[model samples]
Target: MGLIELPAELRLNIYEYFLLRHTRIKGGNQPNNSHLALARVCRTIHIEATPLLHTYISLRTEHQISKFVYHVDASRCNVVTWADVANDGRVMLTPQSSPVSRLFLALRKMTGLKCLRVFDCKSGVRAPDGPRFHGRVILKSEEAMFPDDGAMARSTPIETYKLCVSPTTRSTLFTNIPPTHICTLRLSGDCIFPDASDFSSLRELILDAVTGNHFDRRALDSTFTSSRLETFCYRMGGMGSLELRDSHLESLRTGIGTTIRRLALVGCSRLTGNGLAALFDQLRNLTYLALDMITVRQLQVGFIRVLSPKLELFKFAITNVSYAQPLIAEEVMLCDEIESLIDRDQPPQSMHLKLRDEVLQSSGRWAKWETMVKHRGIDLRTGVWGTEELQ
Candidate 1:
């Protein structure tokens, strides 16, 4: 029988398998060029696989975007669901090849898009020792910028995407972001974040690697705190001393401290022990908490108290944290106590506690806690130093 003689669903499955045979996913997805080649076999096969191939595209330049829209299938441009922009590790913001206007046009064509991921390859592509390069770009707003061509303006919209880009060129696409449809908005790196009031339907927000110099404190006032958010992941960066015990953190407490369900933080070393203690003491509705890379020289065993009655998951990463040896040892003891409490018919029996990082010191207490929580279904993960599988 001929290849087209197979059932439609089975043929589609086989075609997708072959189309993505070259795709790979590590820290992020690697580009695949097989879609271009597979389209050459026949018109029927090409027409069938065009939308499937465009669904998860990793385009990084204007040339690639134009070529994709012109050659692959012009009709499928709006049909794309997930798009990864600035993924080619290009150093220049608007390289000589990919114009920013062209990128804006490419985004305009994606009317049915559900997830859009943006990456600024400046740091990842070029190291500090590389040739010095400097440029800035910003996203501007316009009425007809998003969902252009009168295609599904309010009917179909993007849902959630953790976009990380350096927008300083004053382009007119930032205002086009769907405020009511977006559920998660993650801004990584220092850039002027949009007002929280804009995300009228936002559910979770991640301010990853954002710092103080460019941060707008007024944005996090009533407008931001009033958003219907359940998760907030704030992994801060920079050498500024403005992150600890400030009105910003207090503003969060005063606004939605009792409503946030999951909270994650990478507070700076400047946050004092008192500040750390004051953190968990404010929230009353958290079910999951993750804190990493913090320096708590005086964080005693009692400091890990969960003020939330609904606390279910408490994840702590101690790889880069600067804590005392006794504090680390007591952490193990506390895990043992948690297991004891859970085994004795505690309230959080169905809860999950995950302790991540390479925190196994010479005291040999790591293995003791590791084995104690194995049968109890609690997660006690000791991160490996490098990539050795246990040897």
Candidate 2:
């Protein structure tokens, strides 16, 4: 039998494979010939395959966004579920702009969208004085150009969304978004957003630094504590040490507590070892952990002693790991105070530590760490550690 003469299910599988031929090209006027050929075959095939072609999209410019709506069949947006708008991390700040608003208007038409990411837009004005650097993007209320169709507002199944913005804005862009449809909210800003509690079903939360004078650890805690968040990640930029003490992390136990499975606090420096140990004690089901700043004592307590046996991956991002020698030695050393690292029934499967080439060669610490990681039988992952120039 011919391909189309076969069962309807098998024909659909072929059409799906042909039209959704994987490509990461962000913007273009038309899909490649492979996708076009499938649509041009017959009326029924065109109806079925057109939606599959619009399943994934990445738009960079407002021109691209406008062109997207104009190019694609409005009915084809029925199958579009995942969108990555401007994934490139650049400052897209055009003053007196309405493109972002228009972009939101276009997104409202996609009834089947489940996930969206809008990252690294600069919405801050140039600072008048002091340091000359302003914060990240901040969306205003006027940016809500979404159509007021009650059916469209109530029907979208969009669950996970990420928006990166500045801290000082008086209003937010995603404020009008349907809370019932949103489960994961990734908001990057400097200060604590006052209306975070509005998203009643929010499960996963991410917070990031966007400006100066907004690094209070309590603010990070308050944001995640909005709902029974199952995953929490915080990224701190620019340099400075931070202490995760009672004042900062105490609320975590009562707020998120045993529900959290994945936790990452990256680029922050000098975490108080004991406070982290106490924090570790609460997260008994943690499966993955990533961090940049950690002391030898914290390593001994948190990773060696306190971490759950269910942990599958542990990653350390090295900036200034002068204490790595003791850290490696301590990991290899059998502790009379606690169980041996080798005696674990379900040890982590992978451990990754990314560092500079100079730091790795310093005093043969890298070799020792490799040997220890081998003995522990972990799949070692030192991704692109040798590429960056040493400071």
Candidate 3:
């Protein structure tokens, strides 16, 4: 039978399967030939698969964007929904090659867009003048492309955002970010001074690699006003302080404002034992906490004594051996106890309760917990606290 001989539904299903299959093989990183190859075999396939192919176009050059816009027409890929533009020292931000502006026009065409991410490439494609994009656009700036294209006015209508860029970007985007639509946000790296307008609609925020200098006391006040915020992730990057002030910590504990449920810190070198203790005192609803590359010495002898009661999952990566040695020794004792508990019983029914209360409760070390949990015949998948709840 000819290519056109097949029913529309069957053809579309096959095209979708191939499109998804190719996307999986490429790790969902870029557009590949599979889309184009399918389009070439028949006119029917080309017409049907154009939207799917244009759904995600990773264009790096002005020429690429212009060509794509011309072929798909401004409306077809205008909502060029999701993009990953890399500023790898290749694209320079200029009036002609402004990446953000081109992206804005592409988004205008995409009336159905929901998420947009921008990475800088050395090629500077200027933001073209056209209809505006009305979706959630995340402009993660790795270069000096902020406050350039009248960005704030363009972004004022977006429903949500996740920004991690240089200082100037915060100033420009904050003014434009609509106060009503934002629900979840992630901000990292120092940007422009934040005002109350910046945090009006935020619900959940993940601040990673944030510099303390950027977060003045006033910004903290505005950003935390989101009573709806339920989760916050902070991945510390060699900044030698907890950077969280007393007011920020107090708001969480009082439950008068936002109640953060999950808090994570990775490689927070400056946060002292007291600093962490103070932060923990505020998270009344905290259920999961993960601290990576933190000095074990900071986890004082009475650390888990106060914190472990409410925590369901805790992860700590021991960076310093001197601090971990004592904990390792304690873990050895717990292991020996579990073995004894198992040997003492005919089938070791008591091992589950013993493992849960003794080993997992006290130590944050993942390796030790893995060893003890497996020894008790509990599958790690089913045994872990939140693994079952993951959708």
Candidate 4:
């Protein structure tokens, strides 16, 4: 029998294998030959596979959004479950502009969209006497684009939303949708910290490159205490450090320590050893932990011992080196401490340690450390430490 003559289940599996790859349509003009070929095979197959091909739609420019709004029919638009809007820092959406109004209209037409990501549109233009987000003009006039009774207002609730835009943009965008419907929220760049009432149903919260100054202590405490957050990750880049003090750890421990399963604090150099130890002691449920760019003083054997008991996977990095001490001696002392930890009777299930390449080159004992860890049936990894983009 021919490929199309196979069982319906088998045909669908085959189509999914091929069509899923083209789901994330990037540029406005790029065409998927495979999708087109499959569609051309037969009318029945096309009807079955077209929905899968339109599952994810990514528009990176205003032109792409415009073209998509005008060209794609309602059926294709309705099947998009995930949509990403990442303009190239050029197109500014001013209030009362026809393009801006049309853009919101197009967004409302995606009846099936569950996840939406909007970011990277850092325009320099400023609107006079208009609403602004992170110093960027988001509106040109006072008229509302997404009215309270519009189609977008009554559309399916968004479950996941990632915003890296300005404060005005965020406020304007959320005006139409109920914040309680959001389960996962990822905020980056200069976006303001979300209000306590904004995401009551949030389970996973990711803050990328967000600084400490953005958070209000009362709001932070409210979020940690009120929301049912299970996984929280805070990542910072460059030389900037998040001002996470002992009080923050106290809030985390008292609020979600028992429920949180995965925790990552990267580039939070302001945290002290005592605070980390106390926090880890309470977070007995955590299975995955990532700590990067923490202060060298916090790398104590007691902290490691406290952390090893519960974590299934641990990612640790040493980025804050003490220049007051001899570099080589400091490296040797740190490596020796790690070696001693590996030699312990019971180590973490898996540990990824990131160190300076120069330190690794100078020390020959890392090879022995790896072997010893392996002999103990522990998965140990070592690599050069550096900044990486958070995807």
Candidate 5:
């Protein structure tokens, strides 16, 4: 029997396996030829696969947005559940005739859009129109782009919103969103902290590389305590002027510590091992824990041991050790304990350990730890000094 001669349900499963892979557009400008090729196999297959192809739409440039609006029909537009608008360094906040206005017009047509991400490139972007750009031009332009309150009410509510734009532009953009419907919020770059009252329905909060200068201590504390957040990730980039301290961990412990399942604190150098141990002790319900490039003090083993028994995955990366202090016996024991924890067939199904070359050279026990890590089939990553800086 031919492939098309098979049952409809079986054919749909095969199409989904291939078509679902392209649902998330990850920093790319090119379309997958194989997905497009599969959609063109036959009339029946094309009818079944075309909707899947258009399920997740990513428009990176002004031309792409314009093409999508003009080419995609209403039926295909209705099938789109997620849309990403990444203006790769282009001046989007211009006059009413700008690309952003066109992009919003396209968004209005996507009746099924449940998630929207508006992010920009890290560098190479030009400055705004002028000093008056943000105060007047950008606000006026955004007003024209975003739908009115009545129109937004009629449209499908977006559940997830991810933003990576300049700090000044964040507030104006947020005003357009229906705050009550947003369940997940991901903020990247140097954006200001969000007010908790604005997103009453927020469940998962992710802050990636956000600077601490814009964060208000009182606002952050209230946000954690007030919101019913389930998953929280705060990853700081570089050595900022302000870092998350032990007091912040206290806030987390008192706030959502009992309810949170997954937590990641990367590059939070100010968080001591003792503070983390205290926080982990309170977080009895945590299932996944990731601590990358965090400061490890005397309580290295204590903190790791305090991890919740419900934990399923642990990712830990060691920072560069000073020649003055050298590797202590506790640090070596910490490694041994981690290996034993992974060896057990309990809650933590997977464990990852990252070490610096200098750290391995500082102690021979770490080499033995590396062997044990390999024997236990734990994921291990190693890096040299200055490698991250160059990248």
Candidate 6:
């Protein structure tokens, strides 16, 4: 049937479901093809989903963010409760203008925001301040866009505040965060502790840092302890050397106590086998434990040998190419001869050897290599292999 045959309620429902499936408020950069496609379906759908499009807005360019501010101010949808700028650390601040100011301007206009995540557009790019220096794209206007009490009033009621800035931008922006009305705070940067204000209302906390040494250890411990958070997540970035102390983990463990369920450590280089074992002893209610970039330690001999059976998910990757030789050497040292390696493991009779041969041959090794793991209950030879060889 054509557009006229469908009822208005049905059309609106379709738009709503489309938004539910496609509208990612927390991490999405912008409306996807589904959002754009829904608008093109018909003029009616366009009007219905326009508000959905505005519900979660992301403006990458300074120009786009400005335009969005104007549109929201004029239309006053007030339904756009989530706004994200500086997606994936691409925000640039100019000598005189700043993305944070632009964000401050846009946020002041959106009074209905319940969740806000601000990220630094400039992450790794560092240039000296000059006419041509590449930094966060700041506006040339020196004038404060926000009113005297505007920032405090609008942000006090915000329910969720997420900040993902670089070390530089974090130092400047978090210098004065409106005492948070937010119950959920996800911070991913370096040394960002909003002034020693009480976050008594906060229940969920997530900390992600590429550079861990940037923050003062003692002061951060005090902040985490004071907040009494319920669910806590501490994720190290891809750099792999981010320091995590037993005291911090213990503080986190003690603060959450019986409350924290899921804990994931990503790219942490310093976590030893003994440390993880000790930490696991404290987590009784912990359901999910994930360890990624365990590239720093020997899994088979070190941490995995001591890991808890309660762990639901475990992941590890290579720390560096330099470790590859040691891994191979370790494996080779255990087996005296190639034949000894092959003879050690025997396969069960029920399995087909040809299938095993194909699996082994994929790595450019001879099919006979299967004998190495055969004794470990893997069947490397089946009746089919004998029949084929007799032919």
Q: In candidate 5, what are the lDDT values of residues 1-391, reduced to their tens digit?
A: 8879999999888878776565443442323334667777889988987767667776665566677789878998898887766544222343532432356667777888887777553322244566645643233322334645423663688898776454333333354565677788876545543354455677787766555455545545475434666777776654443366787778778764457788887677667778888988988888887776544453345688778888887777766335334344655666766756665656376666675454446657567756766776666544422212100
Q: Candidate 6: global Cα-lDDT?
A: 0.49
State which candidate has the highest lDDT: 5
Alpha carbon deviation, residue 210, candidate 4 (Å): 1.6
Best by TM-score: 5
Clashes of 4: 4
Worst 10 residues of 1 by lDDT: 382-391
lDDT of 6 by residue, 222-319 (tens): 66444655566666654532466555666665554445555656555555555665666667555454454333335332333333334333232223
Each prediction's total of clashing residue pairs, residues at least 3 apart in sequence or on different chains, is: 7, 3, 30, 4, 0, 27
Model 6 residue 351 CA deviation in Å = 25
Cand. 5 Cα-lDDT: 0.62
RMSD of every candidate to native, in Å, equals 8.2, 8.7, 9.6, 6.3, 5.9, 11.7
lDDT of 1 by residue, 295-334 (tens): 4564444435534556666555443253444356655655
Please give the distance, in angstroms, between residue 199's alpha carbon in candidate 6 and its true position after superposition: 2.3
Per-residue C-alpha lDDT of model 2 across residues 160-182, encoded as one tens digit per residue: 87654444322243444555556
Off by over 4 Å in 6: 1-37, 43-51, 73-75, 87-102, 121-149, 166-168, 173-176, 212-216, 238-241, 256-258, 293-321, 324-391
Give the per-residue lDDT digits (tens) of candidate 3, residues 1-391.
Answer: 8657889888778777876555431311334334557778767778997777666555555566556556666566555454433332222334343335354444445555444443334455544333443332334342223233333344334454544333223223354335456566556445454355545566566665455454544545455554456666665544342355445545555542346666665555445555456666656566666554334443332233334234555544434434443354444353453334333322222211212333544555446645755666533331322211110
Better of 4 and 6 by TM-score: 4
Summarize candidate 4's per-residue lDDT along 302-329 as a digit string, tens digits. 4555664556777777666555333455
